[model samples]
Target: MGKGGSSKDTYNIAHQKGTPGAGGNRGDRLIKEMIHDPYKTRSKLPEPTVCPECQALFQQGRWAWAEVPPNANQELCPACQRIRDRAPAGFLMLSGAFFQEHREEIINLIRNKEKSEKAQHPLKRIMDIEEQEGETVVTFTEIHLPRGVGEALNRAYEGELDYQYTDETSILRVRWHR
Candidate 1:
């Protein structure tokens, strides 16, 4: 309400001191850290690319189950690449007495979940399922699948579900017990 009746200068002067520059971060603000997945492609794959391993097609900026057109570009999709490297982005651990008694039923559920997820998302896949001494470990090619599977298990069977995610990478660990 002074000379020019403008508060812009006052606001600018107040905020100018600690404002981030062109680089964006001033090291003071709590910027949300980005989780990186090495298996993910930084850039878009060329349209019509086909994964040689799984025969998944990369079209319209996504991978999906589709027939390969003649002379389609051949490249390993991220999921197949992760499988080949034996590096999984998600892990689901199942344990407890209830799981032991219902092992077959639980395994079927897990497989069913994977099948449904894979039908929609070609990248989301189960890498491996291992039965250890007292627990079962299922690994996934992508992080989202494990979380989805764990939630499905929790919903269907009413078990204890927990999730662990890291700050540096796109990985998830899910634990389920009944």
Candidate 2:
């Protein structure tokens, strides 16, 4: 809350005496911006550049695969930038007894899924994968990739898949377990 009138103070002056009116549904009053994905590149990126890291071509208003033009503008794509910054926007949590037993297979599947998506959409990328003591977490540069991974795992392994989009931060979290 801000300093002056920002407090969440409620007043009931209308219903001071007698009968109460019907309660109307408060729709947007308390709703926060529920964002599934937030992009960091707000400013216009450098034009028609080639990302040496991913070998992706940034041309014709978006990323694509093209032969490096003569003196092609070279710059890092958003995905590579996210990886370099280590600031992931998507999170996938893989855990459960079943996950422990099939760690390698599941991890391979996730990697393959990411690879396929990355081929089509250069912005979709896996930032990091961490194997913790009991759980494995996969971080992504884009929201759709993690959800895609969770969906792929669910399709392949018939696991329990849960997804949530945060209201404030707009971060996407996905949990897959058997």
Candidate 3:
């Protein structure tokens, strides 16, 4: 009726029974269902963002998570890494004469102090003990100490003590000055 073929031919071509486009609408509907109900599929599980060191997820704050290589030397976390990296070369610079004379006494004092303090302060731990140049440097894990411990230690040895405290860690640099 329109041009070459009759009205039925034109209608059949336009309607296109069993044509490929007939399934296009069904495909689109399937996609919409998949988008709306993603959980229906097994592959749609959520992934987690977690720390490689502590396996703790990063919630909120000023913190960093380093991406460590697989099978590499995985030792310290970012905080410990920074502390160890920035550690002074001669941590316990002690003079030969002073160290030789008072090495045992100093070590004993440190051990005793650690034992006594640890009873009250669970967070406190000795990191390192060394004698370099003319000083004995004892490093400790950062902790909130009562005022008495510092004073008592200073009085017991008649030595000077210095400490630095951060939110997560503490560094105590103790030196005996002669």
Highest TM-score against the true fold, candidate: 1
Candidate 1 residue lDDT tens string, 112-138: 989988998999899998987779999
Question: Model 2 scores what on Cα lDDT?
Answer: 0.80
lDDT of 3 by residue, 1-178 (tens): 6566997875566556444345453212333222221111233212233334443222233123334334432333332433355442112222345445776875676567667765554333355666544456555444332233345546765554454333222333333443
Q: State every prediction's TM-score relative to the real structure.
A: 0.83, 0.75, 0.37
Off by over 4 Å in 1: 1-12, 15-33
- Candidate order by TM-score, decreasing, is 1, 2, 3
lDDT of 3: 0.42
| Candidate 2 segments exceeding 4 Å error | 1-39
**Candidate 1 minimal-lDDT segment of 10 residues:** 21-30
- Model 3 earns a TM-score of 0.37
lDDT of 1: 0.88
**lDDT of candidates 1 onward, in order:** 0.88, 0.80, 0.42
- Tens digit of per-residue lDDT, candidate 2, span 20-101: 4248433224345454434555656666789889888987788877787777877888788888888788899999988889
Q: Which candidate number would show the highest lDDT if scored against the true structure?
A: 1
Decreasing lDDT order of the candidates: 1, 2, 3
